[model samples]
Target: MLGDIWNATLKGMNDLAGSVGEGAREKSLALIEDWLEIFPQLAEYGLEITSFSMGLAISPSLNVELLGKHEDWSDEAIAKRLADHKGEHSITTVLSTIRTAYRLQKKTQAPLRDPLILKIVVRISPEVRVVLGQPILDD
Candidate 1:
């Protein structure tokens, strides 16, 4: 079961690459690689480091818009869309991509007030009302 899940994750990443484009795909793959290197613990959950791919439906990052932005839709509609999409997109992949983007932007941008800086700050914020009462880090 674990092997199958890992294999699927790799294939999914590859699929996502094809969906985007060569340039974006390669960048996404690199970010996933970095994530794999740091999150050795994910192996226990079936995400093997050796199984990264570019074909997955994985988003390149976690900006809310990247995940799915529908300005006209109500919150309930958005929630439903997310639930439907969750089966196709892995939250782990999104989180990794977002973190990678943040790191890159931090290094490339001058000063701390660049536009990308704000985006990164908002992207990783766990302060949204949904989890406000929960602990930031779970051990």
Candidate 2:
């Protein structure tokens, strides 16, 4: 069940990218790669990115879903862990990195703009049976 949901979500993201022009698609894929570069840091907080999607519109945004390494870890636990290390939650850390990257990209003649919306979801377990009507991380 979980796999189906994830697969569908990924497919939707792919479709969105395909619908956009080639330039936007390449930029979005590149942004995803840049975001992946932070895997090590995320691992430190017992978090691993499960899936992600980038949306380019009036305001560019990146939506990320993360799963905890341990089944017992809750969203608060992850947030606390990150706060202890970086004085902020996981979302803040990720957003800061993303915004910085966007700024650098813009400086290099990229079409990305500032104030990018970043949405992060931290799931305690991968055994979720439903994608809807369930409590999300940080809820």
Candidate 3:
């Protein structure tokens, strides 16, 4: 899934990079290098994001009525989870943040359409954090 997006992002970057200056090309290559370095770190949290998205889809306050339509509830695990009754609370909590003030606005759209790679840990989970933006901005 991420490999597809990574390839597409790189293709777009390379295709659009042709008319740019030497400095710009060098910067883009560096950014891509950084992205290549960081993308592998997100593999550990695979199902969490999907579960999070599913929670968003079922949220009544979020106005997403196409819940079952979006996710195939026919799966044994999903069916069992829904049957359990207690699973909904946990799923919702995992995806939501409570604001202290009366500022909770209606969420008309889903939080993530495509996964954005913002940061990744290099070589180890609790090790160095790197950003894709770092390379482009580096002098």
- State each model's CA lDDT, in order: 0.38, 0.49, 0.29
Once fitted onto the true fold, the runs of candidate 2 whose alpha carbons sit more than 4 angstroms away are: 1-39, 70-139
lDDT of 2 by residue, 1-139 (tens): 9999999999999988766656555565555555555567666655555667656652344667655423323445545554655743443565344435444554778443222223352222111111211244743
Candidate 2 C-alpha error for residue 131, in Å: 11
lDDT of 3 by residue, 20-122 (tens): 5454545544433443432232232232212211111111111011111212222353434445534443232212211110122214332322222122211
Give the C-alpha miss distance for residue 131 in model 3, angstroms: 21
TM match of model 2 to true structure: 0.32
Model 3 TM-score relative to the real fold: 0.24
lDDT of 1 by residue, 14-132 (tens): 88877677566456656555443423432332322322223353334322211111122334533554555464334434334544544554587633331221111121122111111
Best model number under lDDT: 2
What is the total number of backbone clashes in candidate 1?
12
